[model samples]
Target: MRESFYRYLMTKRDPNGIDEISHFANAAFFDQAFPKHSDDYHEISHYLELNATYLPSMSVFDEAWQGYLEEVI
Candidate 1:
């Protein structure tokens, strides 16, 4: 999922972003980023806060990912 999101972001958000994405993206961020709707949002934002060079918030990541899903689905 991380790889998917990374690729999505690379093409959509930051075209000039790095090609290498962290391997732990799925384990570290995916689940949190896409949880069920709740009044209190749990940042689900990328957990790789330290490694995120271009992608900023979960909202941004989610948008790119949703677009990617729409294309592939």
Candidate 2:
């Protein structure tokens, strides 16, 4: 799924030529990638923390999460 998403971002087939995968444009894709289920908020948080810890030298997860929250509002 991530690979497909990267391809989507790398491709320039969209009308606007923006390939970052906006939330609305890729709702189904994100829903599949990060499903809303289970009873483990802390577990998920820990998992994300682990990923953020090593995923990038400069983390943008916080900014991205803020943007996602703003979108929800």
TM-score (C-alpha) between model 2 and the true structure: 0.33
lDDT of 1 by residue, 24-54 (tens): 2333344444332321213324233544444
User: What is candidate 2's local distance difference test score?
Assistant: 0.35
Relative to the unseen true structure, what is the C-alpha lDDT of residue 12 in candidate 1, on a scale of 0 to 100?
A: 41
Model 1 residue-pair collision total: 1
Candidates in order have lDDT scores of: 0.40, 0.35
Model 2 lDDT, residue 38, Cα: 26
Model 2 residue 55 CA deviation (Å) reads: 2.2
TM-score of each: 0.36, 0.33
Model 1 pairs in collision = 32-44
Stretch of 10 with least lDDT, candidate 2:
1-10
